[model samples]
Target chain A: MASPDAAAPPPTEPERWRDLDMLLSRPGNLVHSTFDPSPVLRDLIGSYVEVLVVGAGGLGCELLKDLALSGFKNLHVIDMDTIDVSNLNRQFLFRIQDVGKPKAEVAAKRVMERVSGVNIVPHFCRIEDKELEFYNQFQIIVLGLDSIEARSYINSVACGFLEYDADDKPVQETVKPMVDGGTEGFKGHARVIIPGTTPCFECNIWLFPPQVKFPLCTLAETPRTAAHCIEYAHLIKWDEVHSGKPFDADDTEHMQWIYSEALKRAELFGISGVTYSLTQGVVKNIIPAIASTNAIISAACALEALKLVSGCSKSVSNYLTYNGLVGTHIKVTEFVRDTDCLVCGPGTLIELDTTSTLSEFIKMLEEHPKLLMSKASVTHGGNNLYMQSPEVLEQMTRPNLSIPMFELLKGTPFATVHVSGMAESNGKKVSSLRKLRVAFKGVEEASKMDTTESS
Target chain B: MINLFKIKGQKKEEAANSNGGPPVKKQSPGELRLHKDIAELNLPKTTKISFPNGKDDLMNFEATLRPDEGYYLGGSFTFTFQVSPAYPHEAPKVKCKTKVYHPNIDLEGNVCLNILREDWKPVLNINTIIYGLNLLFSQPNDEDPLNHEAAAVLRDNPQKFQRNVQMAMSGGYVDNTHFPRGGGGGGGGGPCYVLCFWLAPPTLAPNANHCTI
Candidate 1:
């Protein structure tokens, strides 16, 4: 060895990461930090910044490892999923033997095993299962979920932090920033949502393509493709033969029954293209997940987490779309906030019949185009107007659900009503709170409107 | 951290499976998870979930969403879900049973929610899909629509889209699409009808004038 004392070969594998570390105290990037630079940057990142990575799938596995390697010690991950036989390609953390185990717990265990001094608390439960207080514990939230609903759910959860003052201005201190990353085949995006500061997920809900819905008539009459056959078997045939027994998608025997029945239906309709995977895909709506796509998105998310916690660099303005399919292309666009967003913007306006009961008002939310809430619990001035969750509270509020709208808001004027309940964001159920300006049509206003309508 | 970007060729469908098929030998992880989701369903008061075939058929159920606001106010849109035993791993096939005029929804009841197709992931539950269906009426997307004509109108002439939505909900014809009647929150004797429709406890009066407030 030529000169044993010569700079120690740049600190070797694990420790080498400390050399160009953003949070390292040795003054590489601390010179330009926007906020006051902490003297103990490494310690701040490790002990002070609490990071939460939602989802423990392909990208989740990568995020855990990347975050661990980047010197963050206190990490927590929550995933309402278990490892599947198919997750092996991109979800490197899991092995063949670890199938059917919760992703979060296993990911935490695996990461800690590989990296030293990192304590990851893995909560193997639904995002909704956790209380609002549980989410408040994290300093930063990183998302690596696949479903739009999950992303939207987490997005709304983060945006839910924005509390508006009397002037309709967001309370700055309550703003929660979320780093969201997603991948589709070779296309992926990493976005940062600083509740009040940046355009939220709901603000840019238009960005996502509308959900896929098959026409019922096609399934009912003009069956043309493999999907139609699968649907016919699942929707009609099973019910005809097995009146009281459920057709389980996970059951091999049940699936086989559907597959065969679908084959017969396909033949009957002269519709071909029903394979096992197609059966699974049509029934379960599964898309083939690629390992590499998950990796690229995960890395982007990991860097975002580091930037968010360490304040090493400016966070992504709002959104960044990445496409690796047609030669690597990354585009950054600043999506403007929707001023009338029901989730993160000013409260929406609602006009209702003053005499309508509280129960009727709740029903109206489902029918209302602008406020199609499937379920809701209302509150005014800190008093629970009605609660739709938790058996005990639901029972307590059951009697009040029948109370008329006018009686419920006796003292309030044409003011905004705060409603809270479950909303589907992306394709996931997220707890959402919205502000709706309720102006009940008193008998006089209703008659005036009726006259205006007829004329 | 996986972004559930759908594979291009992949297709999706939702089903509240029939309680008829081969006897479920054992509950898979997906079914177990689905059970948890159904048990913890947080649906709106106006929405109703019913297993028409009875308790044994958790797989096939009808979820009705009655929007009480927006253009579709007082409209009841029912969606049938067929849950596969492979749920959580695969999304349930969902279809709109009601025919209405909208940008994202076709007259045939095809929906355009990403989660039901390419964006679906195993972590999702029935509750999420139900909420997704709820979202369609509240904020109908004009882009990437199944009803291209409606989407075009929504993009080019929003006032007209509103009118169309109103007509569709009232059980009328919108551009040759004959919609069924009822589900309309008509302004005529509005409060009276709201009272009559809900079948609330007989003690309640139909008119707001009699209220104690």
Candidate 2:
């Protein structure tokens, strides 16, 4: 939003920025080694540091407000989900009128309206829909995602940008820091993932517990618990009765039918505790979200983003867990990075002749002892060199298979090529994505020769 | 330490069994599912289920199959099932107690059944799995075989495969792999019969041996 008067000069130290100025202007022992105590640091945070909030849900709303008030001006938020009445409890930025509107747009507008001078751009699209270059534009990415799959996807995307040098050391400039915050009921966690320095989400994927699943037999036959009954109604009975029609959990009629069915099953089996709300919870797999928890978690995430960009203090070693349930418990755990991490690490390096064709490289990959990839779909820097699936895509990219490897890779000496195909893992065929560092034999020498000729 | 815990558990079960209408302890969803599945079971005349740990401990049971028709006819194969509390959600751990020559079942009693692995859905009950196991005996799929040699023989030479099955069932060695005598006369009974019952601790170890029928 533009200021009402163009001639009006910006406030030197507004009351809203007083708290932020105190931290940035003062000299402190905890500040980063490269940190310079100056007013310019405040300006850097106010206008220069571009931060992207990955979700516009519970924590997203809080993050936008916190970051804006912390003197961050350039903020972008992306979310595919629209605002729902159910999200009103914790997602305060959205109102009853804004129910069907895109969460990112509503959240951005609300935050911008409340906090003047803070520019918030909203992208109401899936995270995967955005190109790799789109993610690279932001200085820092703050994730407020709830789904593990989404977190993993964004984590891989962030780590995908990291570049390593000749010595296998990660280039600091290429490290796109991510502050991840998650809340479930009264429990929450905030983690700073410096792609190359700290463990990426994939490295510590074991931290997430596997989803709870009830066997179909149990639901169909003997449902001992209320949840089993609900799941029975939702999973089996709905499909049997509906036949061709798919059960939409969001549909009021569909949910009502499920609830009634669940109640009847519970009654038949002498089971109790099948409520309408409980049925919704079971079908949607809703995690109890407390507003206070979101605020607390988002605050931690926003502070980390500030510390990372401004070098105000060392980022919380790596992870922080908060439990406000029984009393209040907060713990910080430091996690180490995996050097051989397929996502973050410089992948297995392969030297190729400049004249080698894409099809020839695929043949070499199959024969290569380290990577026996069959029917490999190759992509270099988001460019589809060749795709193995979806007949149409495969047909479109088929012509590129005859193109020279260097030409497909833009004649770059060192490039990361992602090849996905069926590979044997633990004696079983599994689809695997392998990142390979391709070094063209003569490209580096040719570039050096060009420099010499120009000089 | 585990034995002590087992003893304490056994004492509790004994108390509940003596007082029995139903056990004072609530049945888990898995146990309830197993009970319903067992109650509604339409087992083939050749198949029989037995609660080795008695009816009180339904989670751990045995199913003995005497294939009346097929290459495995007159040969009894027993499998022990250890159902978890998470049953219906998770597949029951079924292990073949009696080993015999088969393309789909390995020497270690690991049956290569699709439903028991990735294809297992909650809607599938104990009956479906038993039927799948029975089908394995009758058809002996060579495409997704566990015993590679047996699969190769079955695929390439039928007479040799028949000889291997006969030799293995009658307690002989085929290609250096010894098989105990499992074949008796083919037995038939009414469907859905519990052939045997024996009281054992809930923590009864799965014995890798044939059922004493």
lDDT leader = 2
Model 2 alpha-carbon drift over 4 Å, by segment: A1-13, A357-414, A418-434, A444-455, B1-213
lDDT per residue as tens, model 2, A12-74: 547767877888889898887766667766675665567899999999999999998887899
Worst 10 residues of 2 chain A by lDDT: A1-10
lDDT of 1 by residue, A118-236 (tens): 89999999886775656755667989887766666677666655676656777654666688888777888889887766788766654555446443334544577888889867865
lDDT of 1 at B145: 53
TM-score of model 1 vs. true structure: 0.56
Interface RMSD of 2: 23.6
After superposition, candidate 1 runs with Cα above 4 Å error: A1-14, A20-39, A165-169, A244-247, A269-271, A346-416, A419-455, B1-213
In candidate 2, the residue pairs with backbone N, CA or C atoms under 3 Å apart (3 or more residues apart, or in different chains) clash, namely A214-B89, A215-B88, A215-B89, A215-B122, A216-B122, A216-B123, A217-B122, A217-B123
Q: Quote the lDDT for B55 in model 1.
A: 38
DockQ, structure candidate 2: 0.02
TM-score of chain A of 2: 0.83
